[model samples]
Target chain A: MPAYRPPVIPASEITPRSVYLRRREFMGLMAGAGLALGVGDARAEAPATVPLKTVPGSYKVGEPLTSRDDVTTYNNYYEFGTDKADPSRHSGDFKPRPWTITVDGLVGKPQTFDVDKLIADLPVEERIYRMRCVEAWSMVIPWDGIPLKALLDKVEPQGSAKFVAFETVVRPKEMPGQSGYLQPMPWPYVEGLRLDEAMHPLTILAVGLYGETLPNQNGAPIRLVVPWKYGFKGIKSIVRISLVEKQPPNSWNSLQANEYGFYANVNPGVDHPRWSQATERRIGASGFFGSGRRPTLMFNGYADEVASLYAGMDIRANY
Target chain B: MAMARSPFVDRLTGWGIYVIGFVPAAASFWLGATGGLGADPVRAFEQTLGLWALRFLILTLAITPLRQLAGVNLLRFRRALGLLAFWYAAMHFTVYLTLDRGLIWSTIIPDIARRPFITLGFAALVLLVPLALTSNRLSIRHLGKNWRLLHRLVYVAVSLAGVHYLLATKVLDLTQVVHIGLVVLLLGYRLVRSLIPRPERRAA
Candidate 1:
């Protein structure tokens, strides 16, 4: 195997902590000036808000992070609702603080850890990554968390364990959609990865975004971040992690196996039966209509780091 | 028979229907112009326009049935209602092309070809073009007998629009189901009405 070389991220793409915090202030001053000059049209839009400080980590993408508003407001957490804004609107009353995640299955030691205690024990780092949704939308998000490997190491996997299955918390009362008869998909949204992918350096268990604790809408407390795969592969508000021998059934794949395959790697070559995967709309780049679409990258532009895992396998067939 | 109404009353009613037809479009425009459409304003705007188009199409289909079943003579405003539906549908298509697709023919062509939902929506829009063009009195007079035949295309367009709505939405909820059910009933009434022979008129 060849030695790994981290991609060189240019300094210009990075948003410094000070600049991010002051951006809201700067925009407010501009709005005030515009209003004073009788050009109040510009002030009609709401002022931007400061995001939580996400300290830079080793795995950083040289791209401007999406605005905090877009990141929070535009989400696809079906547990809350199917619409992009549903999570933000419906998840306000959700209680993410007293959370516990259980690790069982084929692990050497099965135990549960309180979310707060886990965060305290593991060192947190911020990773800016390009999150590509299967719906053909993309966002550059600054995520704060520990590597999945850090957590998996604590729950020593047995030799027979070939895959890692993840399960999200299911509180029907808090997650309205889950309780209702009109559930979008099966409850406790489950996802899985090969044992190697779980241990991959690119995969992290994200607890926060933009330097602050994860917003309820953005999968508060903890969520998985698999940079090379589609955003749905990163299950939110996880409660269970199990090591298994065979492949586990995922929420989407189980719902519509043909549409959403288990692998779910962001491969541009494989178009979703419903929509084209050739291009994606960047959430915050364009104006009200859209910023316009750019060609989708293979493996969501993380092919360099994760391509080796699928070297011999037929990605098209797997997808 | 009751006494005939005054011309002022008829004209006022006609104008009322016309103005009310545009209220949804006007409200959507106002919401979009302001920042009230929320995070993804363009999507909200496009969806609102599309929904209004479907509503107008449903209303337009109901006019003939209302007259047949309940003796409600809304036939006078059918042309205006059909035209309004066309207007909203045209605006919906324009937003999709210009704002959503950025008028990129390469992407647009593929989307129409590959996506069944887009294809159905585009087909509905195309079917409405001749109906809209022939809506004026001059074209109505020119086409004469053929005008009725040409306008029958509306049935096809409305059905396609129903399918388009079903395909576009992520979930098939009660609202969508009811809308489609209403469309089916309206179309079924037309079919049954046509199938049954009309009673011969008695000598006055």
Candidate 2:
């Protein structure tokens, strides 16, 4: 594994002098008003208006970002429903506020964090990423959040912790897909990452997108964002984060072991058993009649930074 | 007794079937043009066409079963329904080629050869060709008893289309299961009908 090099991002380089000054003033005002707990309610009600004060993250892809409408509407949140349009339509009743994330399991300092407080305390940044789905569709999104490493650092992983497992909150009353007689998959949807992968600079725990708090359909409170892997690896509406000794089970991998593997890195070389992964339809890239197929990249174009992590291992066999 | 039967009614029903059969394809095209198909319009558009093809194939297969079991004498329109299924299947294939795969022969060829669902769909479409060509009066008159034997391929084609639909879906949800169930029931009816001895025709 590559030695974790601390990114040398001077504070001034991340935010403008005026915005930086205002953020400190804003934080002071926020603390005085006891606003940390109530912030999620206000943000949830009107996300577009109350813009997040964010620094520009190290990674920013130059591609045109997908429209917020499409980003929110076209989702694969099976908790809401199996159809792409089902999430946006059915997630109206989902309550993302009053959320607590439990971080434990092989950690030195196990703790539960109120999601809003965590967002308020940490410095959020905007990182534009190319999200490639396992279904052969791609989108460029500007995600706003802190690096997952920063969150992992808070609890201090134990020596035995080899993997980081995550779980989504199960609220069947709101999430119709979970309440239905025939569920898409076993729920409290679970996902996991290697400890190193979780700590990678590129992995983030996103709270918002497009400079606004995430909409209900888009994993409102918080979600994982690993730009290098297929979109499914970045589990949404995360509730519990556990540092484990053994390789934890992934929801899709558990459902179809032959089709979905633990390491679902975006590789055109490894095709899904049902369909080819050689190319993907770039959402909003082309009109109805035009070809939207774009050749997928190795590790979703993060190969330079991550290729060495799996240098000795056979990717095809692992895939 | 009753008034003389109007010959125009049969002709009108046949024309109506053609018009009604084309609506789904037209509506899908309009949706794609108007941005109603949502993100990944090509996929939505392609799947819609494929779905309509499957629906029409099921409708075509139901005609004989309905007549045999329920005494619904709709056999005259069976040719039009079968032809409609073929046209929709043809359109579905065209869209997949021109839009979905962007007419990439290398990828399309491999998908047809290797992918089980695609191969089954391709075989289904291919089987419909001779049946569609022989649906006319000329071919029927010329071939006599052989025409009926050849037309039995419709059952095979419809069955393949049903299986293709089932395998293409990532998950076997209730909606898909219902569709596949209908196909199985119709095919099973055909099998049961063949085994039982036919009753003698009543003198008209």
Tell how far residue B175 is off in model 1, in angstroms. Answer: 4.2
Per-candidate DockQ vs. reference: 0.15, 0.19
Query: What are the per-residue Cα lDDT tens digits for candidate 1 across A77-111?
Result: 87776767667766765788789999999998999
- Candidate 2 chain A weakest lDDT stretch, 10 residues: A34-43
DockQ for candidate 1, please give it: 0.15
Query: How does candidate 1 score on lDDT?
Result: 0.79
Clashes of 2: 0
Q: What's the TM for model 2?
A: 0.88
Q: What are the chain A TM-scores of the candidates, in order?
A: 0.82, 0.84
| TM-score, chain B, each candidate | 0.90, 0.93
For all predictions in the order shown, the interface RMSD in Å is: 14.4, 16.3
lDDT of each: 0.79, 0.81
